[model samples]
Target chain A: MHETAIAKAILDRITDRLNNLHHASNATAVEVRVGEFRNVDPESLSFAFDSLKKEYPTCIACALNLELIETRALCKDGRHEYKASADNAYRCPNCGSAIGTLVSGKELDITKIVVSQNK
Target chain B: MHGPTELHILERLLEDNEQLASHNQEHFDELGLLAVNLMSAPGAGKTSLIKSTAKLMPADCPIAVIEGDMVGELDVERLREDNIPAYQISTGRACHLDAQMVAQLLHTTKLPDCKILFLENVGNLVCPAEFPLGEHLRIVLLSITEGDDKPIKYPVIFHNCDAVIFTKSDLLPFCKFSLEKAKDAISSLNPAVEFFVVSTISGDGLPQWRNWIVEKANKKISHLHIGL
Candidate 1:
């Protein structure tokens, strides 16, 4: 549901980058890291990107690379780190503590973008 | 004849949103206002809570509300009926209210002068949690009728909140909801979150809820003065 908004943001950011280039170039791919806690579905994001990219000619042929990250947290005890999943009740396996300091799960960042020089 | 170039840009996709949220926060802070974001599932009694709490707030600390919904201004109308200054943001298809939507409202409309502002986010547990609307406090409402497993099922919303209000406490006898189970689940997700069991109909637990808000608002004002 919110994927459409994210898709638009991605397209807007990439298009801005594309527009800033001195030489003419076509965007080839965009890589984004999505975290588990973001409530974003990969398939839905892909569908939204594909459907919306048509409006932006520079991104018409661009590919989206979504790196889905699992939720990982450090325990309050500062001794244990664990992956949060349904099985573990999203708590630390050793201390049974909730996310004290989140290590990686909330990232929704665009790490890389590939573009081909046009002759 | 160069090949594809890989640009290294490790940037948050929602950076624009984060910036706008800060801007909105600055606006609120500058006005000596404590903005609170209220979120919950559809029909979880967000509006009801606001109506009840507005009456409880002191005369000096006036209250303003910004109601967000996918469509319609019925909630805003309800608040206005009580002579409260309220604005409605009708988000056509979006499930959540982003900082941009709020910024647009702030830029276009003039908000009433008030010490406390309540942003009733679009009634959605999932998407609303992802978008911060420049609020000083985030509160989630879970009615007993919604069942006790909601905190576990929708952990993101429950985890990100500063407080959780168990609404519709009057219906507790009729439903199979376990208050202890719900509190335990939420505590696991958020250890420091404050909890309140409020029944707007019966006027139960309203004093505690009102006191919590007043204390937080006072703290915000104090922080503002000391430039914390």
Candidate 2:
């Protein structure tokens, strides 16, 4: 699955960031935001991350925090804001518009990282 | 006593892929090749459509392809048999092709100087949408045999694509697939997405589809010339 690749990327980023820090010993936790439209399963991602992190000493025991964002869209009319879901076929529920500006749900970002400092 | 400190490093997880995708795009731009990424689920007739489109393309405007599959070069062999320059990338374990995979191929191989380069992505619909492979145009195919509810179920892929090709029209009468419902669902997610209905056996929409591709490729060339 692509989640394994994503997990590797996350671990690589974490390790890179840790190495750049002056006194950082290892990463303790990492926070990431994923959107609904990304097709990433949180549980699968977590499992992959946990499995892969063992290879990287810098983030071996790091906890991964995943925040899944909802898919929301703004109608072309610029007034109707609706949750894009299967029920409405991702169209604007109120305006019945086919095209809508996506407000969220495409995000796949690492927001924060916590690291242990070398005393 | 220094404890664990929290650092805010707000960055995209796919930053590497995105950067490489842009680099690949620049390379294609320099070559004046219209890079088209064809993505769809398994067995949606991507290789067949490519073969049909290659046949329809003008003699002056040639086409090359980079086929992605989980294993084997069956599609690549098929394309090569038709005298189409094709390369195969067997993505072991990975469900989708990333920009890096394409970048490596570009580095290793020298493709024929064609007006268009078609990248037929691996057969999965879900993960391929997440990775951008430096394509100027992205198209998704939906075979009628796959049912009309696919667009609604996989909205992300449908929404991000430039167009959708409804394939296997020859079997439409036998299947319960409704073109109207499929179009409605996809247009709801992406109103700008163009639709093409076709069957490789009958060549129903091959001409129109070929024309659209040629027009787009010419437009790309002209647009670059104008910029210069």
Candidate 3:
């Protein structure tokens, strides 16, 4: 039940965005921003989308583009920085204080959707 | 018509989940409750600790528990037998518990009027740490039988936790467990996390652990009253 709920939520978000796209554009692309802190499996999401597309034939031609946004942890020292890797360990290069606040990276959103209507 | 065009699909998938978690946090704070997210590997004595803690809680202080498991309501049944208000969250196959699941349970379950609510996360160290459930405190349990390397093997969970509880300390003599090594390893990952070593069976070190919890809970309540 939990797995299906998660799968359905992802698919619903993807398809909702797809259906809301401007029909005038004939582009087959969509950009999804996944936050590093969300900790969702990209492969599982892709698999869910692939299976979801089987029900909606129009989505088969659409290309799903994933953009990973890395989460940054603020260090205790006077250094402001963001992480660029999957590693959640963001330490201050100056003073070795683990007191770092999360700057950004827990974003899971569909930024935009492009559909082809000319074909 | 084959030219490249950019479409920005910026939408936060977890926004709803986060909002719900925040709501749960607010509810807990309003009730003067300290909600704890208990995480550990299976057979790490999470339920045992709950039973012990519940027994030690003050008579006037109401205690409730939210038990998360992949299947079965055995833990819930045990809690019920103990006369504690308990709710079971069976995730079926999910390895971890998320905020949304807890939020749904809070809405559906007939929780007890309590000052402290313990959410025993699905017995896993990995995924539960990934999602925040708006808990005031996150406590990770490590049994001596599980070995000392667990702190290193699962650093993220330890790194994020507010405290660590070393359970099954009574079995230390029977098992090859190194307390100093585990403490050193955990300190390496999270130097600020509080540590409590307790053996439920022998009642050794349980008082200190219980006092720490009571102190923390009292501080939380005081802070709430002060609008902190």
lDDT string for model 2 (A2-98, tens) is: 9999999999999888888887588899999999888899999999999999999888879999999998888876558888899877777777886
For residues B2-82, could you state the per-residue lDDT of candidate 2 as single tens digits?
888898978888778888888888889888899998999999999999999999999888999999999999999999999
lDDT of 3 by residue, A2-119 (tens): 3233445555665665566565334365567766555466677666666665665556666666777765666645545645232333344456445355566656667776655543
TM-score of each: 0.95, 0.96, 0.79
Sorting all predicted structures by lDDT, with the top scorer first, yields 2, 1, 3
i-RMS values of the candidates, in order?
Answer: 2.7, 3.6, 5.4
State the C-alpha lDDT per candidate: 0.88, 0.89, 0.72
Clashing pairs for model 1 are none
In TM-score terms, candidate 3 sits at: 0.79
Error of 3 at B84 (Å): 1.4
Model 3, DockQ value?
0.32
Indicate the docking level reached by candidate 1.
medium
- Candidate 3 per-residue lDDT, tens place, B40-70, comes to 9999998989888888888766689989999
Model 1 regions lying over 4 Å from their true place: B221-228
Model 2 clash tally, residue pairs: 0
